[model samples]
Target: MKFDAILDPDSSPHEVCELGLLAESYGLNAVWTSNYPSSRDPFINLCPLALASSRIRLGPLVVTPYEMHPYKIAKALASLNELCGGRANILTGGPTGVNATMGMDFSRMVGRTRECVEILKRANPDEALNYEGNIYQVRGYKPTWATDEPPFIYIGANKKQMTHMATGIADGLMLGDTTERRLGSSLRLIEDNLATHGRSRDDLAVSCLIAWHVKEDKKLSSSEAKRHLALRGMLDIWFLETFLDAEECKIVDANRANIFTAYKQKTDVIEGVPDAIVDKLVENLSMSGDYDDIDGHIETLKRYRDMGLDEVAFKLHEDQAAAISVIGERILPAFQSH
Candidate 1:
């Protein structure tokens, strides 16, 4: 299992760079800039990181196709990869509701992503690229410098069709809204789809993004985990529900109903949630505990490795420095040794 730090949208560009440097020092595999409405331009923010770190790979955890044309994304990534001496990655995703907050249309997001990826693959670092697709067209497109080939393209997908397309095209797949118990099922789905297309698991690199909060104080960890769940749960209710077993989903469904009911009644959901309830939510959805007591977390990752995962990117829900240090000092070492 490799560790990567996720840049918070609230963090400034300089702060993100600082976190990137700290993550590198802590032996993290990569630093991923998130593309959200509130986030700084990912490419702009990551340029400083490229200048600061010699080896740590940097790229967007996701750059949606709705926000920018594929040609521009390819150019940005190519430039970054050249600057970093070929240590760049591009994680592309379809549009989300969040994009609507930025006034972007989500209707054709997936189609646009598919079209963009096709165009991106045809692009070489310095060679002229001429592409024509339903959503994008580029004529005489090329990179100026020649240091390395284009960065590998990975797709962040969940649906069957998208997963199948990604398996056939992308170098890697990024899984989001994952839990230990749900991972196996997701992998099985992907494997079945790949087999139907006459492809094997070896042809794809699978990486999952899992939520985690590590702290010395168990109470603090539990509280943070609940807040994290509430925020993510609100954004991706159905996706989060997919992680729970039937019995667990029943519990979550009941809680979710109650939470929404309270909102309707003008009650504060956070105030209504007791610590015990929060802890239960944490146990069901996230990896939370002291950094030293991460044996269970390591075991969960081992299960993912057995399920054909190439890497696991921990999406930390705390201060950037703390997350990097804990993952580097505790999580990475434990997994590497195991």
Candidate 2:
């Protein structure tokens, strides 16, 4: 399986370009810039990286068709791929971030994502014109100058219907913040869906985005993990019940505002929930701690490989180069064939 990295769009273009060079030198398969509603434009931010790097694949992590039209997405992705000589990728998904803040109704996410994928696939072919999908329509639209090396399309999916449809349609699937226990059953459903399409597990690539926070100081690593817990989508009753106790879950549920405040501010202070609770959640939801934690992280990743994952894109933060170093030296080697 391949290993990749995801960077927040907060990084400057120079920083991203430097990180891209580091990632390529370290032999990372891909470097994805996340598309946050509040952050810098990911595609524009990643341009320097796409221009600087020769081998590592580059693209925005997950773009919503609801926020950006599929036609525009195709053009943007095609442009990036052209810059990379066809080493670009894109993860299409349902509503997220600014979409929710903008009060965008994405009730038809399944059909929308499917149509987006179809449009992307058709865009790759030379003869793409005059096709109409329920959610997206193309009327004799063709980018004749578009490169033949179409970016691999991956759909961000978590639940059942979307998972089945995305895996069956896109080139691959990307799961966000999914833990091992959750991954076991999700892969089975995806594999079964692949079979229904006359495809096998080998045909459908699977990958998950996991938070990585290994630091020299264990406390610093844990703090970084806590800062991003809200992104884990753990507010639901069922998800909270998994690692949190009843009263603890209730406490977290009650302080949803506080958590959102901290998340929005990008602070490490987790009000209502105890630091211990935060640490536990961090440990379970992300890979953290110091050098001694390497063994455990490898074991966790091994479980993912066993479950049929093709990659794990580790979402990184502060001291990212150092984090990439540790991963390059530790995690990548563990998964690489000697």
Candidate 3:
């Protein structure tokens, strides 16, 4: 499995670009940024990365349809691709959490996202794309110049309907919440959808996003895991409940309820979480542990490869440079040997 880095929007552009350059130097595949409403604009922030890194591909891991029109996405992507000599990828998603956070409507996000992808494809190759849809309309829109090739367009999806639509229309599929069992089921869903379209599994690249925190100290690892889960759990409750199973959804909802209840009761459930509880939470929600002495991380990644994931992007939560170094010094070499 190939490794990539995800830049948090809270990070500064200079920090993101520096990490991108370091990732490139470490021989990683790409650097993707989040497009959450509160975050910095990914395309704009990526300019320094485009100028600084020669090889690492840059793009949003997934931009929401409600946040920007396809025309703008196409324009930004085209410009970035040209500037980077054709090393940009565009990953998009139907608006959910982002829209909710930004107070944008999510009702027409799926239809809008489809139209956006079509517009992007047409806008590439310097062709005027005339599009009219329920949510957006574009007439005779084309970029001034085109790159050698259009950026790869991936769709972020987690539910059955979204998976089917993505497999039918997208260049690739991006999945998150990457536990081994979840990865297996997600790949199966993608394969099943592709088969329905009379397409082979090889026709699409499956990218899994794993929330990762690396540390040698068990206590620190546990704390990091708790912090990650608290944030992700809140987001999932707000946006991803539809993608989860009944039991999983219950857990998320119950957790959210508990957190809110604690808030109302003038207490802090999140702060009071102990190390043991954090360890359990990490095991349930994230792919993290000590990756220094043994090949545990490598073996876990190989399991992802075995499950038919084409790529695995580690969404590092801390210390980007050190994370890259660990991946370069330990994880990448292990994968290459295999």
Candidate 4:
């Protein structure tokens, strides 16, 4: 499977560009920055990387149509693609944290996402695009200067309805926080949807977003992983069920405040939850531990590769350069022949 590096939105444009250059030197496929309301504009942030890098694809991750119109998305994406010489990529969908912060409408998210993807897929510089969809309408819009190859358009989908929608239309499906135990079901769902749409596995690409917390120090790695653990699937019961028991899942659910509080406080202290349970969650949900644990992580990644993943994007937290080096030196070599 191919590997991609995902950066936090807090990273500045220059920092992201430097990191993208580093990733390119390491032979990584792509570099993506998180899209959040409070962070730098993702599309603008990637421009520097797009200009500076030659081989590595660059773009923003999970930009919902609710926050911006499909036409505008195409405009920015096309501009970025031109700068990258056609290596720009994007993941679009709905129900992001932006929806909560902006109080945007969430109804009919599936249809809206479909329209956005359709608009992006139909974007062409050679011809004017005039589309009329249930949720979006574009008239006399033409990106005449965007003559480079079209940017890869991915749907940020994980659930059944969204995954099914992606299989039929999107260039790729970007699943977030999907673990090994649940990956089979997710893949099956995509396969079933592709068959129903009269499409094959080769028609679509599949990738998952995994949290990366490995550090030089095992204790520091575990601490960072715990501090950010609350973001892993939001400690959802469905994800916890893969490792935790019924009562333990209940405890986690009941202590949601503690988990989120720990994250907010920038510490690893998750009060009211057992240490064993927390460890289990960390082991099952994220890739953590010191350098010694990388070989084992490589094994887990190999299992994912064998399971038919086309790509896996590692979400880096702290010391991104170190994590990128580990992935480049230790991880990339393992999948070179695959």
Candidate 5:
């Protein structure tokens, strides 16, 4: 399996360039930029990195069709792909709740995402795209300057309906915060969907977003993981059920406000929930702990590979450069040889 790094969007373009070069030198596969509402434009953020790196794949994560039309997304993505020599990627999905606060409509998400992918697939400079969909449409729209090979388009899907939609249309599927217990079922759904669509497993690349919070100090590492616990699938009941029992799930659900408070406050002290439950979520949902924990996470990654992941994108939290070095020097060697 290939290992990729998903950088925090706060990094300046120059910083991203430096890190992209670092990751490339270490034999990492790709470098992805997270698409946060308040951050720099993810596509533009990769320009410096794209111009500097030779081999690492680069692109924005989870661009929704509601905020930006697929035509506009394709234009930017195609330009980025040219800068990277055709190694760019784009993962499109429905409008996120965080983005929804900006007044984006969240209804008909599956249809919007599906139509976005459909429009993107045909967004080629070779021909003027004249197509119609329930949510999006393009009438004789073509970018003659976008002549490079189209970048990889992945659907940010983690559920059954979206997975089935992606298997039929997208180049790949990006499963967010998916755990070991749930991965097998997700992949099975993908396989069955692909077979129904008459496509092979090789036709689509599969990747997962895993939180990486390891630090030199174990205490700091665990604390950071706890502070960010609310992000693991937004502490959804589906993911919580993988490890937490029904009662535990209810407790987590009830104290979600406290969890979010801690996350927003950037503190480790969750007021209403027990430390044990928080630790359990961190353990099951993320790869955390100190330097000594690297070996175990390596084994976890290997299991993901064995279960059929084409790539695993680690979402680095703090000291991203140091994390990249650790992953490059330690975790990458284990899988690169294969």
Candidate 6:
């Protein structure tokens, strides 16, 4: 399996470029930044990294069509791709993050996501798009300047309908913040669909987003985990069910607001939720802990490899340089195919 680095949206352009350069040297396949309402514009933020790095691919993740039109997405990606010499990639899907960060609703998410992804897949800088879909329509403007190639499009999905759509049409499926067993289950769903639709697994890359926090100071590591733990799939019961029991899941479900409070307040003190539950969430949902725990992380990542993951996008939190060094020296070597 290949390894990739995913940066939180809060990371500056300089940090992203520096990490992209480092990742290129480490033989990481791609670099991605989170897309949210309050963060820097994805296209502009990635420009520095795209120019600085020769080998590492770069793009944004889970960019919703609801927030911006699909045509605009295509245009932005095409421009970014030209800068990167066609090493751009994207995970297009619904307003999953936008709903929380920007107050947009996901009432008809599946259909909207399908149209967005379909439009992205058809994005070509060489020719004009006269495409028409229920949710989107593009006419009279063919992108004309990209000399290399269009970005590789991946459909970011979790549920059944979107997974089926992604497996059939998109180049890959980007699953965010899922556990090993659930990943296997989700893959089975996609694989079955691939066979049914006569699509080859060779053409599609399956990647997952893992929140990473491996600091030399164990306390700092755990604290970072707790600080970011609320973002773990937004305490969705389906994700939490993999680890939490019925009553515990209810308790967590009830305390969902508190998780958001912790994240929004930028405080680790989750007032309503118990510390044990918070810690448990961090333990199961993320790649958390100190440097000594990296071996364990490698082991868990190997499980993902064995289960047929093409890439693992480790989303870095704090002490990012240190995290990058460890990944370059240890994790990348373990997964290198020789």
TM-score of every model versus the real structure: 0.86, 0.95, 0.87, 0.98, 0.98, 0.95
lDDT of 1 by residue, 1-338 (tens): 56667767666678878999998888888888877676678888888888888878888867877777787888888888877888888899777545778786667656777887887778875678888787688999766674585677889876677887787778778888565556777788888877887888888778887777778877677656665665443524455465444555555555765655543453334444455554556675667877665787777777788777778777765666887787787778877764
lDDT of 4 by residue, 1-338 (tens): 88999997799999999999999999999999899778889999998898888899988988988999999999999999999999999988877778888988699999999999999989897788999999889999987898898899889887888988889999989888877888878888989999999999999999998999999999999999999888887777877887788999999999999999998899899999999988998998999999999999999999888888889999998899989999999999998997
* Candidate 5 accuracy as TM-score: 0.98
lDDT of 5 by residue, 41-70 (tens): 899999999988888888888788878888
Of the two candidates 3 and 5, the one with more favorable TM-score, higher being better, is: 5
* Candidate 3 wrongly placed segments (more than 4 Å): 231-252, 257-278, 292-294
The local lDDT score (0 to 100) that residue 87 gets in candidate 2 is 93
Better of 2 and 5 by TM-score: 5
> Which pairs of residues clash in candidate 2, taking residues 3 or more apart in a chain or in different chains?
none
Worst 10 residues of 5 by lDDT: 96-105
lDDT score, candidate 2, position 334: 86
lDDT of 1 at 129: 85
Stretches off by above 4 angstroms in model 2 are 245-247
Q: Which candidate has the highest lDDT of all?
A: 4
RMSD of 3: 3.8
lDDT for model 4 comes to: 0.90
Candidate 4 vs 5: which has more lDDT: 4
lDDT measured at residue 122 in model 6 versus the true structure, 0 to 100? 73
Q: TM-score of predicted model 3?
A: 0.87
Worst 10 residues of 1 by lDDT: 263-272
lDDT of 3 at 233: 33
